[model samples]
Structures are given as structure tokens and as C-alpha cells.
Target chain A: MPEPMGFFTDTTVCIGCKACEVACKEWNQLPAENGGIRELSGDSYDNTRRLDGIHWRHVRFIEQFKGPYDGRWLMMSDVCKHCVQAGCLEVCPTGAIIRTEFDTVVIQSDVCNGCRACIAACPFGVIDINPVSGTAQKCTLCYDRLKVGLEPACSKACPTDSIQFGSIVELRTRAQKRVDQLKSQGVKAELYGADPNGALGGLNSFYLLVDQPEVYGLPRNPQLPTRNLAKSSSFSLASAAVLGVLALVGLRKRRMDDMGGPGAGGSN
Target chain B: MSDTFFSGAPHWAWLIILYFFVGGIAGGACFLAAVVDWFGGPEDRPVVRTGYSVAAWGAILSGALLTIDLGRPLRFWHMLFQSANVPALMFKGWSPISFGAWAILVFGLFAVLSALGGMAEEGRLHNPALRAVGGAVRGGLAKVVGGVAGLLGVFIAGYTGILLSVTNRPIWADSPWLGALFVASGASTGAAALILLAPGRGATEQSLARLSAFDTKALVVELLVLVLFVASLGSVNRVWIGFWGLVLLVGVVGLGIVAPLRLHLQRRPLASAAKLVLLGGFLLRVATILASEGIERYRVAAGM
Candidate 1:
């Protein structure tokens, strides 16, 4: 629906401006949540720090040093990936978290029980509970704007077109061209979360990275928690089965004592 | 190399820890009682009564803890009956929390009924009608209810572990062994609860010995599960092994299992060890939840 809206965040051109963050807060009508005041993070201009309950769009500042003087500041504007198999959607008990018509994940505040299940389930750590609303909140990919045939506020406000919003298909074509162009220019450019075959079935909001994905604080291999369900469930069953055996041992020992045996269980 | 130490975990917080503790302990107690009622015979009524009462109370406590901790405390009905729900007996999806709620609620109800079945033995229900209520729940009915409650109790014990394992956090998702660890710990709590609340007042030396022996077995299970859980985490990160691991080792494994085993072997008063195990239970839950700090707490990372 709606041509599978998505965001192609080209961190290569990002200028570390707070415009995306500001636009997100302004458009979503989110309250000031960075310690309830305009306080600096002391970790450079990354004052908002992370994607959280309030701040959906975060500009990550990764200052890397190769030597005493050789260093580079890698700035990337990060947002929810809106994964195809979103862990948050999979774990939300109340079904409050749903993939939108545009294939972006959105949490329904009214239906959210605020058990914070999604908070942990989200591999991206994008979803958080609004303190005031008492519900899980995350980037909606500007669901309202998408409905009205407009772009997300963050992309609209991005001065350098670093954050582009449009059909995922179109964005992928553009992102691939950019990656190849940068690679030809000797930039060590790479694509992250772009493949539809990876664990998450790919991200609607993919990224174009200049360095390794891990260098940007992104997981080298992100996966849904459900992947371990079979293994984990099996372990639990094994545990319960062991406990059941112990319960048998307990009952048997008691029976022996009752029948006037030597009380073997008394020692062990 | 990543510069930040952000752990993308959950914000389960204190209330949830408390809920897990209560739910585990309660489920354990109920399960223990159900076991006794179904199979322990007439001589084991005291332990059965104690077990049922503890389970009933535990179920009630957990239910309250969860509801009050919820963001939308009033809309519990949404969890119980929505398009997603199948009414009171509803269970859909891998939402272990919702399933746990159903298990605890149902287990609590059965536990209460089972506990009431013990009322006739306490005397003073001379009002023929009231006595009949108690009498009806006795005998075959008690066995059926106890059997069901016991099974639910076991589920309750392991449900929290399953819930945590399903999350993407490595400390939690690292192993399925958490389920085993929880069930074992829960059963230990059940024995400990019975030892604390109803310490065999007219219990035969034989019956007391039996309970103690069974508790030792429960401790054995607990220690084994802990070992399995730790083994699964094997060399991930020492940050957790340093603090939460220490808590699991000392607070749970040492205090919970070793102390009780020693106390039981010496034929000494087990109240101290039982109390220690109870305390260890709460500490274990708290430490695990707090351990999520580096991963999912107030930190920043590249992406999920």
C-alpha cells in the first residue's frame, strides 16, 4: 500500500544538523524529553543521544581516531528501520504494534498496555514508552503525512537531502547508484539493511554507509528474537523435564521413608 | 570498533522484577501443593493445605503486581478479550506475558478452590451449607484441581524465562536454559514457602523428613539448572558474569542451593536456609532486570 514508503538515509552526505530531530519533534507534537530541558549530552552535539520514547530521529556522532591527529567524525541520522519481520510487532501482547498500510511499523497508544514488551523485543531499540502518554511510541514513518501524499517531516526538513523518503523500490535504485558512484570515487561505500534476504527480511528504511556497518553502531547481523524460539523452548522443556524427574526422586524418597526404609534421602 | 556500550534491551524495571519474583514463588508454591494433594495421601494434608493457600495467595499477589505495573492498568480486558483474544481462555501468538496472565489467573482460581477444599479439615465450618462447599471440593475434585493447578504453576515458573529469552538481548536470549533455571528456582520457592508458612505443626517426624528430603531434591534441580544456564552464556561478556552472574552464583546458586542442601543434610533447622533461598529468589530477578542496563537501558547505539 502507498508504494511501500521508506527512508534511504545517506549518512555519507549527512551534516550532523539537528534539523531532522527538530522536525520530527515539531511534526509529531512530541514533548521535550532530553532531561526535560535543553541540556547538552556532553558527548558532542549529540544532545538527544539516542532514539527513545520522545526522540525518534537521532543524529549519531561517531568520532573515530586512527592516530593522535588522524581522526574523522562520522555523523549519521538514525531512525527506525521499520523491519519486514519487526521484533516489536511480533512480541506486542495487545497487538498494539502493527505494520501500517505503508509497511512501516506503528504502535497504537490506545491499545498498548505499556508492558514494555516491545521495548525489549525491538532489535533497533527504536520504540520507547512515552512517560506522559504511558504508551509505547516510535517513528511512524510519518504515517499521517504518508496518508495525505506528503513526505516525512525529517526528510522534508533535511537541508542536504541526506534523508530521502519515497517508495522503497525507487529509493533502493537511487541508493545502489549512489553506492556505486561513491565506490568508484574510492570512498569504501557500502549498503546496510538493503538486502531483502537477511534475517530481518530487509529494512524499509535502509542506509548507505561509508564504513563497516558495525562502525556506525549498527548490528553486523540483526535478527528477530523469534529465531531462537525453537531452541529456547526446547531448553525450557528440558529444564522442566529435569525438574519433573527431581520431583519423582522427591516423591520416591518420601515413599521409602514412609515405608520404614533406611532414609537414604536424608543424606543427599 | 563500536565506541558506545549501548545494550539494546527492555525497560522491564522494578515492578516487572517484583512481578516475576511473586509469580515464580507463587506458581512454585501452588505446584508443590497440587503435587501433595494429588499424590501425598491422607497423612500429607498439612503440606497440601499449606501449598494450596500459598499458591492461591501467590496467584492473587502476582495478578495484582502485573495489573498495577501495566501502563494501561484499566484495559486488562484488552489482553483478555480482543480481536486478538479468545475470551477468558484466550491465548494467541507468542506473547508470553499475556499467556502468563492467563496461566496465573487460572492457576490462582484453581489454587483458591483447592485451598478451600482444605477448610473442612480446619474445623468451624459447622454451617452445613458452607461445609458442603468445602466438602464438594474435597476428594476427587481436589485431585483434579490440584493436578491442573500444578501444571499451570510449572508454566508460571518457566513463563518469565521464556518471555526474557524471546527478547533480542544476548544476556537473556543467549539461552533457553533460563526456563529450566526458573522452573527449578520456582519449585525451590514452593518448598521454602511451605517450610516458612506451615512448618508441619502435628507433622510426623517422618512427614517433616519427607518435606525436607523433597526440598533437597528441588535444590538439586535448581543447582543443575543454574549450571546449565551459566554454561550456555559461556564467554559472551564478563560485564554480566561480573555482576548479574555473581548474583546468580552467590545469591542464587550459593545461598539458594548449597546452603539449603547443607542445612538439610545436617538435620538442622532449615528456616535460615529457606529464608536465604526466598531472599535469593528476589535478588536474582532484580539483578537480571538491572543487568539489562548496558544493553537496553538509557544508552545509545548505531541501530538495533
Candidate 2:
């Protein structure tokens, strides 16, 4: 397997230019959203709403303006985390989704029956059905590019150096240093999904956020779907056991009723 | 997009919901047939036969509904075999859908065999060779096949709920009682279905009374489990407090459980009660699935 590669997106440096989104669509041959017809959302300049099947990379424009220029407009370029413990890969019944040699997850389109089990299992809400393909799809973290020793299109197109792509080890070191620098400047900067010991086993594509994770539509603590499986199955077993005993008791009661009464066998 | 950040529900609409209902009956009927064949009197043969027939046909319908629900129906076989690698069957124990696919296939085999055996016992098979095979299934080997199939049936009934519970969907993942609730409901619905179908097949008044007795107990258990399932949801229970909750309370609880129990106690017609029970079972699945889907939509609309 190749060295584990990933993306470290620093929201502080992101210009919200949407260059990464355009680069991803162009390189991936992804169809334009709503047939390329742009509509003013009135929320901000962000017409492209969220990351989905067609929109692999989305630039969120969070307008936190008080009066005029008091508060800051936070911008975060969201993409698939390519989580170390991917819920989508885990719940896929067809084995269509696989972890690539680069340690990034990829869905084999030809094999996907589009059951959409992965979509519900995903805590990140990353996977969705591609209308044209009729199969669940999301960012592959540029699996095609990584195969030939190339960086991902989104990262390559990012002119601000906000979206850094490199070996996981090197990126973590750089991210920590940046976090320290920002903290010294009192920016309240922190790294999300950088710790390898975290709940989702840490994400390959992590983020550097200035505020709470929820402000950017990210879960504070995402979990795998299988976390509740054992408990659910246990309760099911107990219920089945109770029902079995009830069946035997019902049968016993019927025999007694038949033996004692004169018109017991007559149907109602 | 939603407040939960979920892109959308899995698009598991009517087809999947129908499968859950049919699959429950198939599993429950097979289990009842096995129990009757093993423990009940010989006079219960008609009930056993009807149970096996329901199990056989219900299993087939369940399989069909599941396959047709897939986005690519032609690739339904991918659930069993790994399409990326030919000839090698795929099995993931951690994945409920993987385990469920295999369970359905195996349970279908047993259900069909039992139904054929019951048919042969009634002298329905014309061919001597086919009759002989059916006789073997119904003869000494009957207990073995029914026993295994009964257990698998229970698994199928409960596994469907477990399938929903292991998702990020709001109400689905919030509580562990979905599987328990489904199992109880499966029993009640299974008994109701047999009660409806048994009389036409020459079921004895004694056998019908026995089934009615069983159905009553199952309904009580179902009612109890339904309460526990809702109560366990905590704040997630808010998602079902409106129209969906009303359906669950009135349609499922009052009409489905209470009405059926009242009719049975008052010595009213069993068929009417059975029909109501079946309706209630379908409504339960509808309420659970749509409410979760609606919650996801509500979250997105509310915005973070």
C-alpha cells in the first residue's frame, strides 16, 4: 500500500473563491448542478449549497455580520473526510465501496446496486445517489489522480494554499504548527479529526476551524452505524424469547378450554 | 443540508416498507407452523398447512419486493456475490443487509420445502417422484426443517427493524427497541394472517380458537413493546409527536390492538379483528419510516 495521503483544509486561509469546487467538477466530469442555471440564494454569494453526489466540493459562506463589519464571514471548503473508519464502506452490502491503497475510500460504480444503505449509515451526510448513474456516490479524494502520482484536482486548484494535500504524517505536523501560530495570535484555532485516537479513528481529510464545528454543519462527534447493532439485536432476542413462551401458554390454555366446555370447539 | 447535516434519506419508500410487513408475516407464520407441527394435536393439521403456505408465498413476495426496490434491479445478485470478483460470494457479518440477504435466501428455501411437504400430505402432488420428495420433508424430517426455518423466520422479522436502527436517521438510531417492537408486531401480524387464511383450508374450530388465543397474547406483547420503543426515544420522540404520532396511537394502538382484543373478548368475528390487525401492522411500518424521513427534511429546512 502507498503512504497514507490526505487533505488538511485550513478554513482561516480559505478565500471562499470556489476555485476548488469548479476544479473538482471540471476534472471529475461531474454534471453541472441544476443544469448550470445559477440562482441567488439570498443567504450569501454561495449558490452551490452543500456537498452531495454531484457537488463533491462545496464552499460554505457563513455570514456572521453584526451591524455592518463587526463580525467575520467564515468560509470553509467542505469535502468528503475519507474517514479512517468510514461508515459508508462499513454498511455497503455489495462491497462496492473499498479503501484504496492511498487509504482513501472509493465506490466502484459498476458494482453498486444503489441500495443506498451507505447513505443512511454515513453520519457525515456525504454520500448521495447520482441521478445520471443511479448509484450512491461522493468524493473519491481523487483516487484517479493519486494512482498516477498526482495531487487531487481540488487541492491543486486551490490558489490560497488553504487546502493542503500531502502525506498524512507531514500534513499533521504542518497543521499543528499552523494551529500553534494562530493560537498565539489568539484566533481560537483548533484541528478537527487530527487526533488518530478520536471516535471515527480520525479522518484522513480533517479541518482547521475557528469556531464550533456545528457552525459549519460538521458533527462534533460522529459515530459509526454499527455502534448500536449489538444492543438492538440483544433486545430483539429477548422479545422473541418472551413471544415464544406466550405461544406455548396460549396453546396450553386452548387445550384446557376444549377439554372442559361443551361448545368449546365451535368457531365464533 | 438539514440541521442534522444529512443529505437526505435513503429513498427507502413504499417497496421497502411493504417488504418489512410481508417478511414479518412470512417469518411469524413459519414459526407458528413449526410449533403446531411439533407440539399441537393432529387436529391442528389444517392450521399448520395454512401457516406453511402463507410462509412460502410471503417469503417469495418479500424477496421480490426487496429486489425490485434496488436502484439497479438487474444487479440484485450483487447483494450475495461480489461483483468486483466473479464466483466468490460476499458475506459481511457486521453489515445487517449482508446478513439479511443471506437469511432471506436460506429461509425461502425452508419455507418452500415445508409448503410443498404440506401440499403433498394433502395428496395434491400428481407426480409420484415429487410426492415422494415432499413426503420426506413432511415425514420424519419435518421437525428438523421446521425448527431451523422457525428460528430463521424470527431472525428475519426482527432483523428488518435492526436494519433501520443501525442508521444515522433520527428516530431509527435513537432507540434500541425497534427490533423488539418489530418482533412483537411480527408475531401479532403473523397470527392475524393465519387466522384470516386458516378457515378456508378446513381449519378446525378448535384450531381457530387456539390461533385466536395466540394472537391476543401477541397483541398485548406488541402493545407493551411499542410503548417502550417510543419512550426510549427521549428527545428524538418529538419527531413523531404530530401527525405520525396520531397514526401510531389511534390507528395502531386503538384500532389495531385494542379493537382486535375487544372483539376477541366479546366473541365477535375473528376475521374482522384479523383484518384490522393486518392494517395496523402496515401502518406501524409506514409511521416509523416516514416520520424519520420527515425529521431529516425538517432539520434541513430549519437550518443550523
Candidate 3:
């Protein structure tokens, strides 16, 4: 009924303060820093142990450029893409997961039977089952907040406005402009998940990246599970048919043998 | 596992495991139905009737498992109710899975009717309507129902493997033969399960042996494909090599092929040996696929 809502993540401006993470926790009433105090993961300042059920919004800090000429820290807050052709949406059995009128993916916790289907179907590894609730939970893109006339908590709390929230069309335009602006500034920035025709039908929440998507733990080509369902089923059916024929032929031969070479039953 | 190697294993891997698990159960039920019908036991009529019913149930269960894995489970009906994009590898459509679902429903209904007919034949019910329904099911209709269910189950089982094989993941995509291998594995596993569950006899043992033989063949083929796939990678990362090699040996060679062979050769009872082999093979396939993902990730990280 309303204009479809989405996220436009401009990674170039991300300062990696992780305020988005805290904001998400506060708004969603999620636990802050799983496994007690946050310890350094030894990779970088990232100690949140990757995206899980509780931590919907993860601010990844990737340090690159070994010595002197290449010293830059890449910072980006990642969340569910809420894909148009969402694999998780396609695989849920209990109707627990739904695409809202906002066009964002959300799991109804009350309806979820802790089946973990959405967890497996998500290509981004974004959705997970909360160990405590036994139900799949992820970034609702602040569905509750959006219901009221307010922006998502993460976007509001973000000092740098790296995680921008808006309509899908506007976000794509903004993402492209941001990439162009970064390129003008001599930074080779690119937009990810903005191509509506791309794999997974592009994302409602897209990204701006300085490096390859794989570096940021993103699938280069995400696919749906139902794609090969037919071919696989055909193969299975063919095998069964062959088996059936063989069984039938074998049965007929045995029956003939039992009937005395098919002549004993004839009373000519 | 090394951080680099284990990094970003996709969620599809787990869903694939779930697919194989559910499909295996369905395929097994179908094979049981065939075995029961082929050999006339005191419970043969009931077994045959229930076998189709169980296969139908399995198909429905598998479908449910698949749906649960989706991000939007509510839109699952779109695959059935809407038009599908054909060329897209993940295009939701009237696929074998969907067909299998339909087949399961149809076959299940007929099988239930046939079972009711068997009960009627045994004088368990005096109602003429029930007898007339049973008589209809017993004459010509029963075979059609069994045929359709068996066909659908076969597809459901084989497709699980082909789905992975179609992926560009080197471990799976390279092997065109993997699909056939999966079908054989499904059939063998299904037959073995059915044989075990049915009353024990020498004939059942022989049937199980036949199923085991097919499994052995599939294992050999899978092993060969694994070797070729691994060798083609050509001096991959150490972690990738070790992990995949271990998987091939233990999962493919040990559990899928050798365990069943050992059980058969040792002259253990059909039910006992079939159960062990069936369970072992199912686990082996799932473990192999998961390990394959791990290996692929390792190689990717190593830039090989």
C-alpha cells in the first residue's frame, strides 16, 4: 500500500564506529556483544563473532594495504539484503517468513517453529536462529520502527549516515551517485546488489564496495534452490522407470517359468 | 579449521543437506513399496498399500523441509500457482519436486483406498460402499498409483544430487555423472530401508543384495568422479586437498560403498545390515557435500 522501503548502504563513508550495531541492539531489544565482553578477534577490531540471530547489523572492519602507500581500513555495516527473489523466502514451509508491503524480508518469530529453513536458505549467511528463542531472527530493517513515521534505529544512530534507508529506487540512484562521487575523488568504488537484473534479482538493501564482493564475504552469484528441482526430479523419475521396467520384466520371466513355460495352463 | 579456509561457507550448503536427507526418506519409502508388491507376504497387501502412503508422506515432508529453508515460506505457493522462469537455474516452477508433490498426493490417496480394500477383503468392514471402493482400487488402479509414486520418488531422490552438481562449485559442478550416482544411491538406500523394515526372509536378503550391488556401483562411480574432480584441481591448497581427500575416502569410499559391502559379505541378517548401510550412506553423502564446500572455500581463499 505504501512505497516499498529499503536500505542504501554507502560503504565509502563508513567510519566503522559500530554505533549501528549498538542502535540495532537497543531498538530490537537484542543482546549487545554476545559471549560476554567483546574481545579482539585478532583479525581486526571485529570481535562480535560475525552476524548471528542477535547481531542483525554487523560493522565489518577489514584492514588492507600492507605498508606505506596502501594504508586504509575498510568499514561497512552489513545487514540482510531483503532480496526481491529471496532464497529464504522461497524455502520457508510454515509461512513464517514474509515479504512485507515495505518489500523487506522479515521472519515472524511467533509463527516460526525454529525450523532453521530461512537460516540455510539465506545466501548472505545473515539469518540465524536465536539460541535463546529457538526461532529464526535477523535484521527486520527495523520493521517496528518503520511502522511509525521514523527511520530505522541503525540509520538514525549512524553518525556518518553510511547505512542510508529510503525507497528502493531512490536508494539505487543514491548508491550509484555515491560510487561516482568516490571515483571522482580517485577512489575506485563500485555499487553491489544495485542491478535489478543481477543474481537474486538484486537486493532491496544494496552496498557500495571498494574491493571485490568476495572480500566482504558476499556470494558473487547467489542462486535459488528451486532452479534445479525439475532436472533433479526428472533424473530420479527416469531411474525409477528403468528400475520398474526391469522389475516387471523379471517378474514376467519368473511367472512364465512357474506356469511351466507358459504351456501347462493351456488345455488344448 | 583455518579462518581463511572456513570463511563464508554459503547457507545453501546446509539447505542442500536438508534436501538430501528428506529426499532419501521419500525414495526409501517408494523402494519399499515396490519390494512389498513384488514379493507376496502375509502382510504384503498391507505393506504395499502403506508403502505408497508412506512414500507420499515422505514427499510432503521433504517439500516442507525445503520450504522451511526458504526466506519467505509464505510465497512457496508461487512455484505452483504462478508461471516459472525456465532458464534460471533456481527458477521456481512446476519442477520435479512440484510434480513429486502432486504425485505423492494422488498416489497416497489411491494407496489408502487400496489398503482399505485389503481390509474389506479380510471382512474387517461390512459396508458395501467400502467394499466397492476397495474393489475398484484392487483392480488395475493400485498398479497405476504405485507406478506414479515410485516414479515421483525416484525423481525426488536423484534431483537432490543433480541440483548440487549443476552448481559451479568445482567439487560438484565438474561431475556430470554425479546425478546418476545420486539416483543409484537413492534407489539403493531406499530399497535397503524397505527390505529391512519388511519381514526377514532369504528372498528379501537377495533383494537387498541387489540394492547393495547398485549402491556399490554408485559408490565406485562417485569415487572415480571424486578422483577426477580432485586431480583436475591440480595441486590445490593443502587444506583443500586434505579435507576433500578425507571426505572421499571416509564418506564416499568407506561409508557409501565399503560398509554396505562388508555387511553383505559378513552374512549378517538383511534387516540389520541394510539399516546400517542405509544410515551410513545417507550420512556419507551429506558429509561429502559439506566437506566439498569446505574444500572449495579453502581453495578460493588460497587463490588457487
Highest-scoring model, lDDT: 2
- Show where candidate 2 strays beyond 4 Å: A37-44, A66-69, A255-268, B1-7, B126-132, B297-304
TM-score of each: 0.92, 0.94, 0.72
- Per-prediction TM-score of chain B? 0.88, 0.95, 0.69
Tell me the lDDT of candidate 2.
0.86
Tens-digit lDDT string for candidate 3 (A54-113): 889988776676898968887779888899988667765445678998999898876565
Best by DockQ: 2
Q: Please give, for residues B8-106, the per-residue lDDT of candidate 3 as tens digits.
A: 333555665755765665664575465546543443454455455456566666667766764456645533443133322222333333343444455
- lDDT for model 1: 0.77
Candidate 1 lDDT tens digits, A33-68: 645778776757677767887888989888887998
**When only chain A is evaluated, what TM-score does every model earn?**
0.93, 0.94, 0.91
lDDT by residue for model 2 (B251-296), tens: 9999989999999999798899999999999999999988877645
Q: After superposition, how far is residue B189 of candidate 3 from its true place, in Å?
A: 2.1
Q: Model 1, stretches more than 4 Å misplaced? A: A34-36, A67-69, A256-268, B1-7, B83-90, B124-133, B200-202, B241-245, B294-304
Q: Weakest 10 consecutive residues, lDDT, candidate 2 chain B? A: B295-304
